[model samples]
Target chain A: MIDMLTNILQTTVLYSTPLILAAMGGLFSERSGVVNIGLEGLMTMGAFIAAITSLSTGNPWIGLIAAMIAGVILALPHAVAAITFKADQVVIGVAINFLALGLSVYLVKFMYDAGQTPTVQKKLEAVAIPGLSKIPILGPSIFQASPFTYIAIVVVILSYIILYKTTFGMRLRAVGEHPHAAETAGISVIAMRYTAVLISGALAAIGGACLSISIGSEFNQGTVAGQGFIALAALIFGKWNPFGALGAATFFGFAVALSLMGQLIGLSKYVPSEVLSMLPYVLTIIALASFVGRAVAPSALGKPFEKGSR
Target chain B: MSQLNKQSTIVTALISIFLAMIIGSIAMQVAGYNPFAAYQALFVGSLFQAFDLGETIRTTTPLILTGLAVAIAFRTGLFNIGVEGQMIVAQLASLLVGIKLNLPPVLHMIVAVLVGGIAGAIWGFIPGFLKAVRGVNEVIICIMMNFIALYLSNVLVRNWLSEQGTDSTPKIPESASLRVDFLSEMFDSSRVHLGIIIALIMAFVMYILLWKTKRGYELRAVGYNPSAAEYAGINVKRNIILSMVISGFFAGLAGAGELLGTQGYMAIQSAFTGIGFDGIAVALLGANTPIGVILAALLFGVLTYGSQNMEHVAQVPPELIRVVVAAIIFFVAANISGILLGAVKKKRRAKES
Candidate 1:
C-alpha cells in the first residue's frame, strides 16, 4: 500500500507540472490587477507553437522558447486592448481564449495536413541527479523528474522575489491595488501592468510548452484540457502567493493522480475514464464551495482602466 | 455627433480594426494564401450564401442567450466567468428533467427550459453571494464554478445517467424538445430554428428591463458605483445577486437552446462549449447593452458559419476567423477604453475650462 501510494505520487508530480507553471503565470497577471482570462488561450497557443518548434528543431529547449514567444505574441492583443485600449479586461481575456483555440487549431489543419501534429520520436528525456536521486524514496521521486519540474519550483521562488521584493514588483502590485495611487507615485501604472500581463503571457506559454514537449510529445487541438482553469483555481486557492499557488497546483495534481490511482486499484470500475477525468473539475467546484481562502485581489482587478473615469 | 466629442473613440476603433484587418490580410498573404480570396470567402460565405446564412442564424440562437448572460452580469458590475459552468449545470438539470417528466408540450417545454434556467441561476448565485457577502471576486469564483460544473457533469453522465446513466442520455421526449426545425424546411434544409426568435424577444425584453424598469435602474446604478449606491439607500448586495441570477437564467436558456432546441438530447460534450466565455466578447462588443448583444451575437453567428464553409471549401484554416474575432474584440475593447479615457480627459479639461 505504501509503495502504491508512493508511485501514484510520482505520477501526480508529473501531471501537476503544467498546471503549476500556468498558475504561476496567472499569479503574475492577477497580482498586477489584470484579469487574465486569456491564460487558457495562451497555453493552447503555446502548446501548438511548441509542437511546431520541437518538430522543426528537434530540440525541446527551442520548443520551450518558441512557445513563450508565441504566448507573448498572443497576449499582445490582451495587453494592447486591456492596458492600452482600456477595454474590459475580462472580455479581452475571453476573446484571447477563443482566438487562441481557433487560430491554433485552424493553423494545425492548414499546416499539419491534419488536426494533429505527427507524433515525434524525440522527446524530452527525464533526468535524475546523482546525489539527490539517491537521498530517499521522496528524493528519488522528486529528483527523478523533468527539468521543467525543477524550473517550476525555481520560478515559484522567483515569482515571489519579483512580486514582493523588487522595485518592479512593488510597482506591479501598486498598480493592481490602486492604479490611481500608483499613478501619483509616478509608477506608470499602465506600463507596469502591461509588463506584468506580458510576463504572464510568456510564463503561460512556457507552461504550455512544458505540456506539449514534456508529456504528450505531440500536440492536439485541445491539449490544454482545462489546465489553465486549474491554474486559475490555484491562483485563487493560493491567495495570490507563489508558494501557495504551487501547493495548490500540487493538490490538484494529486486529485488527478488519485483518480488515476482509483481506477488502477479498481476502486470504481463501474465509472468510466471520462468520469474520472472530470474529478479535477469536480474538486475545483468543491473547493470553491468550501471557500478556500480570502481573495483580496488588487482593488482595481476587473475595473477597466479608463482614463476618463471621474 | 459634436455632442459626442469623442467621435474620435469611434474613429479610433475603426482605425484599429482597419489596422487589424490589414495586419491579418498581410499575415495571410505572407502565408501564401490570397488575402483577397479569404476576405471574399469570409463575406460571401457569412452573409451571401443562403445555406451558410441559415446556419449562421442557427448558431446565433444560443449565442444571444449567452451574450445576454454576460451583459446582464456586467451591468451589475459582476464579471460572471462562471456562465460556462452555470450553463453546463443548468443543461444537465434540464436534460435530466427533460427525459423524466411527461407533460403537455407547453408545460413540458416551460419546465424543461425554466428548470435549466433556475439551475444556472443557482450557479451564478453562488459567486454573486460570495462577492456580495464575503467580498470574494466573482471572476475567480465563477471560473472555479465552471470547472466544478464540467467535472460534475462528467461524473453524473458516467455514473448516474449514461444509457439511463451512460456517457449519453436518452433522447429528450418530443414534447420537451423545442420545435427548432419549423423554419428549417424553408431555410435550405438548415438547422435555423425558432430559438432565434426567442433570442430576439429576450434581447428586446432585456433592453426594456435595463433601460425602463426601476429594478433595472438600481442594477445599473449599483454597477456604476456600488458604494455610492449603498449610500443612496440601494441594497447593493441584493441587486447584485439578482443581476447575476437574471443573467444565469439566460445562460441556462443558452444551454437549453443547444440541448433541447438544437441537439434534442444530452451529451457530456455539452458542457463548457465556450459559449459562456464567448458571451463575454459579445457582451463587450455590444457594450453590455441589450441591442448590442443581439447585434454582436448575430455577427458572431455569421463569422462561425462562414468559417465552417471556408474550411470545407477553401482549406483556409477556419481559425483565421477566430483571429479576426480576436482582432475585432481587441479593436472594440480599445475603442471603449479610449472613450472612457477621453471622458476623463474632457472632465479634467472641463475643470480647467
Candidate 2:
C-alpha cells in the first residue's frame, strides 16, 4: 500500500509539472488582462522546437533555450495582433493554435520525413537531493525529481513575488483592472501587455519543453495535446493566483495520475478506463461551476484598450 | 454602411487568401517543392476530375453544417468551439438509432437525424446552461466537453457497439443510410448523398431565420450588446441558451450527415476529426454569413481534398494547407486589409497633393 501510494504520488508530481508551469504562464497573461487561448499552440511549438534542437545538439538544456526562443517567435505575432492590432484575442489565439500545430508538423515532416521527431539522446532525468532522497515516500516523489520539476516550483514562487510585490506587477494589475487608470498613472498599457504576453509565451513554451525532454522522451503531434487547456483550467480554478494555480494543477495531475493507474489500483473494476479518462474534464467543469465561488477575471480581460475612449 | 462593410469584408477575404497563398508558396520553396506544380495538382485533383469533385462535395456536406453551426454561434456572440464535441456525440447517437431502431425507411432516417440532433443539443446545453447561470467561461467548458465526448464515444463504442475486436461500431442498415444511386452514378461512383441537399437547405434556413425572424433579431440584438438588449426587454439568458442549442443542432446534423451518408459506422477516435476546428476557419472566412459559409466551405473542401493530391503528386506534406488556412485566419482576424486600405488612401492623397 505504501509503495503504491508512493508510485501514485510520484506520477502525480510528474504529470503536474507542465501544468504548473503553464498555469503560472497563464496567470501572468490573464492577470495582465490578456486572454491567451493560444497556449496550446505555443506549447506545441515549444515541444517541437525542444525535441528538434535536443536531437541535433544532444543537449536538453540548449534545446530548452531554443524552445523558449521559438515560443517568443510564435508569441510575437499574437502580441502584435492582440496588443497592437487590437484583434479579437480569442479568435487570433485559436488561429495561432492551428498555425502552431500545422507549422510544427509540417516542419517535422519536411525535415525528418516523418510525423514526429526522432527521440533525442539527451533527456532531463531525475536527480536526488542528498538529505531528502533518504526520506520515506515523500522523498522519491518530491525531492528526487526532474530539474524541470524544481524549476516549476521555483517559477510558482517567482510568479507570486513578481505579481504581488513588484512595481511592475502592480502596474500590470492596474492595466488589467483599468487600462485608462493605468494610462493616467503613466503606465504604458500596450507595453505592459506585450511584456506579460511574451513572458506567458516563454513560460508556456518551457512547460512544453518539460513535456518533451523531461516527462516524455520525444515530441509528436500529440505530445502537447490538451495539456495547455488543462493548464488554462488550472489557472481559472486557482482563481489566477500563482499558489492557487499550483494547488489546482497538482490536483488535476493527481486526477490524471489516478486515471492512468486505475487498473493497477483496482479502480478500473468499477469504471472503464475510457470512462476514467473523463474524470479530469468533468471535474474541471464542476470546479469551474461550483468550487470556485465567483472567480472574477480581470476587468479589461479580452477587451482592447482603446485610447481616449470609454 | 452595412453594404460598404460587406464589400470591404469580401475584399479583405480575397487579400488574406492571396497573402496566404504567397506564404504557402514560400513554405513550398523552403521545403524544396515546386509551388506551381503543387498548385496545379491541388486545383486539378479537386476540380477537373469528376470523382474528386464528388468527393469534394462529400467533404463540403459536413463542413456546411459545422460552418453554419459556428457561424450562427458567432452571430450570437458565442464561440462554439464545442461544435466538434457536439457533432461526434450526435454521430454516435444517430448511429445507434440507425442500428437499434426498427422502423420504416423514411421514418427511421428522420428519427435517427432528430435523435442525433437532440443528443447534440443536450451536450451543448451543459456549457450553455453553465455559462448562463454560473457565469463560467464557455470556451474552457467547451474544450473540456470535447475531450469528454471523445472518451465517452470511445467507451460507448467499446462496450456496446463494437464488433468483437475492432474499435469501430458495425455499419447500419441500408434503410437508414443516406446513399442514393443517381448521385453516385453522376459523380463516377463517389459517395455523394442527399446530405448535400440537407446541408444547403439548412444554410438557407439559417440565413432566413437570422435575417427574417423576430427571434433571430433578439438573438442578434443580445449578441450586439447584451445590456442594451436586456433594457429593451429581451430575455438575454434564454437567447444565449437558445443560440447554443440551435448551434448544437446544426453541429449534430453535420455528424448525422457524415455517418448516414459518407461513413456508416463510428470508429474510436484517438484525436478529433478536425471538421469542427476547420469549421471555425470556414465561419471566419465566410464572415459568419450563410452565403459566405457556403463559399468558404467550398474553398476549404477544395483545399482539403486537393491537398491529398498535392501530397501524392508534388511530394509535399498535406499539412502545408493547414498552415495556409491558419495564415488566412490570422490575416482576417488582424483586419490586414484595413491597413492596406489606409496605406492606399495615404498614397492617393500624396499623389493628389
Candidate 3:
C-alpha cells in the first residue's frame, strides 16, 4: 500500500513536470495577450527534434538546447504572421499546427528515411539525492528524481516572481489588460507581447525536452498528446495566474498518474483505457462548463497589437 | 485602387493557393522529378481514373461541410475548434441511425443526418453557453471538448457499438449505404456518390444565411462588434449560441457526407478525422466564404490525391503537400501587412509624383 501510494505520487510528479512547464509557457503567451493555439504544434515539434537530435548526437543536453532553438525557429513564422501582420492569431495558429505536423514528418523522412527517429540514449533518468538516499520513504520519494523535476518547481516560483514582481512583467500585464493605458505609460505593447510569447516558446521547449530526454526518450509523432491543450486549460482554470496554473497542471498530472496507477493495482482490466484517458478532459469540461462568471482573458489575447493602431 | 477586394476575397485566396501550388511544382522539378509529368499524373491520379475522381469528390464533400462549418462560426466570432468533436459525435449518432433500425432508405437517411446534426449541435453549445453567460473563452472550451469527444467515441466503439462482424458498428444497412460505385461501373472506374450534390446545396444555404437573411446579419453584426450589436437591439448572447448551433449543423453535415457518401459506415478509430481541424485551414485558404471553401476543398482534394502518385513515382513524400499548405498560410498571414504596406507606399508615391 505504501509502495502504491509512493508510485502514484512519483508518477504525478513526473507527469506534472511537463504540464507545469508548458502551463507556465501558456501563462507567458496568453498573459501577453497573444492566444497561442500553436503551442501544441510547437511542443510536438520540439519533442520530435529533441529526440532525433539527442539520438543523433548522443548528448541529451545538446538535444535540449537544440530543441529550444528548433522551437524558436518554428515560432518565427507564426510570430511574424501573427504579431506583425495582424493576421488572425487563431487561423495562423491552426496553420502552424498543420505545418509542424507535415514538416516534422517530412524532415524525419528525409533524414532517417523512416516514419520516426530512433529512441534516445543517455536519458535524464531519475536520480536520488545523495544525502537523502539513506532516509525512509518520504525522503526517498521527495528527494530523489530527475533534475527537470526540481527545475519545474523552481520555474513555478521563478515564473510567479517574474510575472508579478518584475517591471518587465508589469509592462506585459499592462499591455494585456489595456494597451492604451500601457502605451500612455510608455510601455511598448508590441515589444512586451513579443517578449512574453518568446518566453512562452522557450518555456514550452523545456516541456518538450522533459518529454523527449527524461520522461519518454523517444520521438513519436503523438508524444505531446494534447498536453499543450491541457496547459491551455490550466492557464484558463488558473485564471491566468502562475499559482492557479500550477494547481490545474497538477490536477491533470494526477489524473494521468491515476491512469498509470490503475495499470499497477489491477484496475486497468476493469476500466477501459480510453475512459481513463478521458478523465482529464472530462474534468476540464466540467470545470470550464460551470461558468460561474467571466474568466476574462487578457483583453488583448487574440487581438494582434499593431503599432499605430491604438 | 481596390483591386484586392475587387476580385473578391475568395479569388484573392485562390490566387495565393495557385502561387503556392506552383512553388510546390517548382520544388518538385528542382528535386529532379519531371514537373509536367508529375503534375499530369497528379491530375490523372485524382480525376482521370474513375476511382481517382471518386476519391477527389469524396474528399471534397466533407471539406465543403467542415469548411462552411468553420466559416460560419468565424463569421460569428466564435472559433468552433470542437468541429472535429462535433463531427465525431455526429458520426457515432449517424452510425447508430444508419445501422440500428430496420427502416426504409429515405427515412433512415434523413434520420441519420438530422440526428447527427442534433448531436453535434448539442455538443457544440456547451462552450457557447459558457461563453455567452460566464465569459469563458470558447476556443479553449471547444478544444477540450474535442479531446473528450475523441475518447468518448473510442469508448462507444469498444463497449456498445462494436459491429457483429468487426470491432466497429455494423456496416450501414443496404437501405442506408450511399455507394455510387454503380455509376462508376458505368465508366469502368469510379466511386463518386450523390453526397457532393448535398454538400453544394448546404453551401448555398449557408451563403444565403450569412449574407441575405436577418438572423445572418445579426450574427455578422455580433461578430464585428458585440457591444455595438447589443446597443442596436441585437441579442448578442442569443446570436453567439445560435452561431455555435449553426456551426455544429455544418460540422455534422461533414460527418454525414463522410458516412453517407463514402465510408458506407462509421467507426471511431477509422481515421484521424482531420476534416474539422483541416477545415480551419480550408476556411482561411478559402477566405471563409462558401464558394471559396468549395474551391479550396477541391484543390486540397487534388493535392492530397495527386501527392499519393507523386510519392510513389517521384520518391518525394506526400508530406510535401504540407509544406505547400504551411507556406501558403505563412504567406497569407505573414504578408498581409507587407501587401498593405506596399499598397500604401504605391499610393504615397503616386501622390509624390
- DockQ, per model, reads 0.56, 0.75, 0.64
- Candidate 1 lDDT over A238-266, as tens digits, reads 77789888998898888777777776767
Each candidate's interface RMSD, rounded to one decimal? 2.8, 1.3, 2.2
Candidate 2 per-residue lDDT, tens place, A138-204, comes to 9999999999899999999999888899999999899888999999889999999999999999999
Please write out the lDDT profile of model 1 over residues B1-353, one tens digit for every residue: 11113454345445545766776776577667777777778768877766667778888888899999998888887887888988888889889888888789878887888898899988988888877877666777787678778878877776777785356877898788776455776677777766677788889989899999999999999988899999999999999999988988899888877777777766666335777877876776666767767877887787777776666666578777777777777766667445656798999999998
How many clashing residue pairs appear in each of the predictions shown?
A: 8, 0, 3
Off by over 4 Å in 3: A133-142, A291-293, A307-310, B1-7, B22-41, B163-167, B186-189, B266-271, B334-352
Better of 1 and 2 by lDDT: 2
Q: Give per-residue CA lDDT, model 3, range A1-310, as digits (tens).
A: 8777777777888898888888888888888788888887788777887888888788887888888888787777777777777777877787777777777776677667787777777887777888885566555555787777888889899999988999988888888888878888888877787777777777787787888789996766667768878877777777788998899888888888877778678877899767777787777667766742344567777877756676
Model 2, retained fraction of real contacts? Answer: 0.75
Query: What does the lDDT read for residue A297 in candidate 1?
Result: 54
lDDT of 3 by residue, B193-248 (tens): 66677789989998999899999999999988889999999999999999999888
True contacts kept of each: 0.68, 0.75, 0.77
Best by TM-score: 2
Where is model 1 chain B poorest over a 10-residue stretch in terms of lDDT? B1-10
